[model samples]
Target: MAQTVSFMAVGRFEVREQTAANAGVHMTSTSPHREPIRVGVVGLSASGGWAATAHVPALAGLDGYELRALSASSAESARAAGEKYAVPLAFASAEELARSEEVDLVVVTVKVPHHLELIRPALEAGKMVFSEWPLGADLAQAEELADLAHRRGVLTAVGLQARSAPPLRYLRDLVAEGYVGRVLSTSMLGSGWIGGATYDDNYAYVLDITSGATLLSIPFGHSVDALTMVLGEFRAVSALIENLRPEVTNITSGEVAAKSAEDQIAVTGVLESGAVAAMHFRGGTSRATAFHWEINGTEGDLVVKADRAQWWYGGTQLYGARGEEGALTELPVPARYQRSLKQWTERSADPACSVAHEYALLRDQITGGLAPDTHGVPDFRHAVRLHGLLDRIRGAARVGRKVTLTEQGS
Candidate 1:
């Protein structure tokens, strides 16, 4: 019989341990022999946010995981979200959710600035934690959280969900399977859609570099993460980061805001496999190409294009040409690449698609079905490494020189 823990937020908070039948909590599990991993989401709001848009739908569509609890900024909001999402429990803060025995996994979906505070409690409680991208506001915070998670021996996952995307996974396999036969060079150009000449009042924080949610860290960070996954880590890199748009108009209130976050980022690096890599990311949508990437090799070439830089969302198309081929032809990602999420292919444009895939990988990881080291899910340690790389990029840009990974303590 599966054990189900129940919680009642009566004025304060109370926990009661019981079976599903006795607690009157309906347990939904895809596997009859195994219980679902109960998940508590921090920052789930009734008004709708990334957590509502992505994580709610993701957990809803997947098995072996249940959206059990949620925490909002206030008790009223938490209760509202609980009722809206049909979650069994709700809390006013992340610490309450983290300390709950009912929640086997605590997912931190808040902003970058609050990531350290939200994640620290979960790690301290020895609960499995899944934090969104960037991991922290900067390298120091990420390193600190990673160190704490390590000390706690907790299972951790970061929201580098592009690694779980079907197309990206297929692309990685193709490159590994010698589809492009010893890649000689790769180039990518993208538009971040933020840090542009216009901004939304709600997203004004992105214009501040101190927020750590800049164009370079959000869009470029996600895109580059996928790039490194397909290819390999950078052995050395030279970068140029510039703030082309110093002022941006607020689309909502028509007020002008001074922007410090960079609008342009250029990076050139050597991959661990000795392949040359170059990437250029600019703010705002482009009339010509929003996103384009090409990999050239001795025997063949592959190209990936999307309607926008955020390939993880949708419109990611793959094309390739080899040896005697006269033209590049579209290469459809095979069904096998979708794994258990083949049903979600049609909904690839939805933000929940890749998130669902990531949740599935996390489920596998937690259920002992997937080895921690072998699974493609980026953990806290991986986040720390990526954060360090971003630091190196900033350092290189500041010094106007090339930075070697080994010399920079990679």
Candidate 2:
């Protein structure tokens, strides 16, 4: 049975007090929104990318953020982005934008290799920073940035937006409320980035294990994180990783690339709750299903399935069955679980929904003067913890043995 915890809702903000020890884990809190925060987005390109499509739309739809400045690789690109986005200030370099008095929050949307370089300046300036996931090139870099943020006492956030995803959030509550009885075991199977036969030119580097944005690190990472958000952390895990697709054709470049990245990944683990868990991610979509997940408990079961691998993008369906309650039937998310954000409608992408939630949580934290861990916002330390987990999973695969996880944090 799950422990009962009391909570209070203030508008869309939920309030609960958590000790400071859990620095990077999600807690709860409530506070009214304050003045709009001035944001300078690094890599907000006019040419369109993740930042342009997701962050731009997400921020534009939010109330507490003012998209003030943009930074690009070149002065011309910077000026062009500013004109296109209607941002008044633009800089050719991240340092200039981070140091500007006009930028209260620095949003780093650059490539994985550039995160450390782009985010360091903002951290040094004691400005709030939000960087995309795979927070650093590797665990070491991620820890370095996290340590800097901690030392500087500046608020920080990461792109592990899976926690803020609406359906995932609802799923968490359902599990905590014992909707599935006692979670005996959980499993997930999904199509991964490499699952496709062809790849984009931009993702060519992702095919290399050295890039840090591998099949195991991104889609797999995000999926696992989202799973843990609802189920709990793993106590130990055994994993197998293989590079079945050693050679992949780049659809855009019309070239065959030697892919060192693993395309077939599998993991079996024990959750903190003592429930068994297993996950398998493959490079291509299945002929029958794109994604499927099941949670079996002593008295009931819950299932979440999606047509695409990125369910966090607001495209998942829920089903449940209790005792002999016929077959698993669809469970509609209640209106109460829906946040009051006007932009948090059915049309929002998974990234946009999660980003908007993170913004709201940060706005409340800054306005309420709450601690970092006191909300569900995933921060740098959270990224470090995830990095450690990934490392352990890799180790398990390396040694062909189940490894124990003792590292702490979210």
Candidate 3:
């Protein structure tokens, strides 16, 4: 029988066969042969937020990983987070955690501004790293990190979680199979009113380009990453953005805040594959507008309605519809994984569901050592390319012109 326990200690979670004492702290075997990877998570504060909710639970639930250590900026918070999440070891700082021999994989889920600070230390320690996306605050940062990893022959996986979404996978396969016919154009509409929690310190850094919370960096990143994967690399893009959410509650503190990061972003671009895409990220309304996207092609049209992805510690559900002629065809995630996916999905889990899938997929990749085509884990190569595109978008917004991507010979 599956054991169920619900708690509000750190983040809300109800796991079967685990307690608050073991929730994110321990791992059990799904198969007798599955060897668990001992992982130490640094940045348990807001930056390590996903590690608590997604990585910690995801790793614990699976037969693959054992959560050994939890770290914060200080030993006190680290101990607090470790106790709260049930991690056995708590470190005062990330540097100390990285050096521990028990930590095979050092997962760095830190703030964008502190990404380099934490990740560099882990890489230098010769541990595999699974950091969050935009990989770095900018192209230069990304390049620097990638260069270090390349030099050391260390394994790295960025938080580009959408790559593992079944719906996204379906879309990519459909396009390759010519189900969507010749893709002609793609448009994505994703926006909703920002809650008071939307303006917390976790996101303030984004407002400052140096902090890495640029519109072209995050919200724009979520949809664009999925769009590009299903479609192809972009060639040129023209865009603009607006700061609509002037005020928000501290996402972490629950206090109202002054926000300047653009609430909406406007963009149009053509992929090297010749498919055109127009995307919008908005956050000024009272109503929440879920992810709404459509692709027009010669064979047929594919449309994705609101919220195709979901994440819950209990598990994850991918929900999306494939359409041709404006009618629904197939739904993959919510239907397929509905049994394993948890019910709390409609809330915090949705934003990071795609990312969660990538972790499971990449965990399998590293098991085989570094090799090409391992569970479709993308290397620094793709991350560098993504950073370049982001640079173009940021630069375009500054220059008020279309930024073109450099096309390299295949």
Identify the superior model by lDDT, candidate 1 or candidate 2: 1
Which residue pairs clash within candidate 2?
Answer: 194-283, 195-283, 195-284, 313-350
lDDT of 3 by residue, 128-168 (tens): 77787778877888889989876765666777676666566
Q: Which stretches of candidate 2 lie over 4 Å from their true place?
A: 1-33, 348-351, 369-374
Top-scoring candidate (lDDT): 1
A best-first ranking of the candidates according to their TM-score comes to 2, 1, 3
Choose 2 or 3, whichever is better by lDDT. 2
The residue ranges of model 3 lying beyond 4 angstroms of the native Cα positions read: 1-34, 45-48, 192-203, 244-260, 284-288, 307-326, 333-355, 369-375, 408-410
Which 10 residues in a row give candidate 3 its minimum summed lDDT?
Answer: 8-17
Give lDDT tens digits, candidate 2, residues 170-235. 788889899889999999998885636678877777877877887788878988888888888999
lDDT of 1: 0.82
